[model samples]
Target: MAWKFETSGLDGQCELFGVNIFKYRWRDCRETAAVTDPHYGVEKMFHVYEVEIDGQLRRFAAGEFSNCVWGFYLEQG
Candidate 1:
């Protein structure tokens, strides 16, 4: 993750009327992983699956749930 900052204002006060956190990194990554059987039991076996994006990868052995996408939609292709 990377970050940058900038200042702006009509009075050039840089604080009288300004902005914060102008931007953030929408990062990406990739790595080798294994596959699991989704029908091995009564529940889906999605224990540790590396997620992909646009036919590409972004993470490996991804098991974190606190940061999982609660919901998603194609705002843009």
Candidate 2:
């Protein structure tokens, strides 16, 4: 299913395994996660986001990370 993410901002950032990682909080403050594992020379990163679907909240993570663009994904349980 497609996701609709609210506005987000960087809450923290760090480096691990020589890769830069970032932490962010969603607008609701109930969903948050970090992004790492750069793709295309750090132009693309990966992250998992929690979404509410069918009156239930779920986590999903399936997408690339862009420097100028922010996308959403659900984490696998």
Highest-scoring model, lDDT: 2
Model 1 scores worst on lDDT over the 10 consecutive residues at: 68-77
lDDT of 1: 0.23
Per-residue lDDT of 9-69 in model 2, one digit per residue for the tens?
2323332222222432222434345433333323223344444434555454434344544
Residue 56 accuracy (lDDT) in model 1? 56
Full-model lDDT for every candidate: 0.23, 0.37
Displacement of residue 16 (Cα, Å) in model 1 is 36
- Work out the TM-score per prediction: 0.16, 0.28
lDDT of 1 by residue, 1-77 (tens): 21111122232122211221112122323422233322232211122222334455332222221243111111111
What would the TM-score be for candidate 1 when compared with the true structure? 0.16
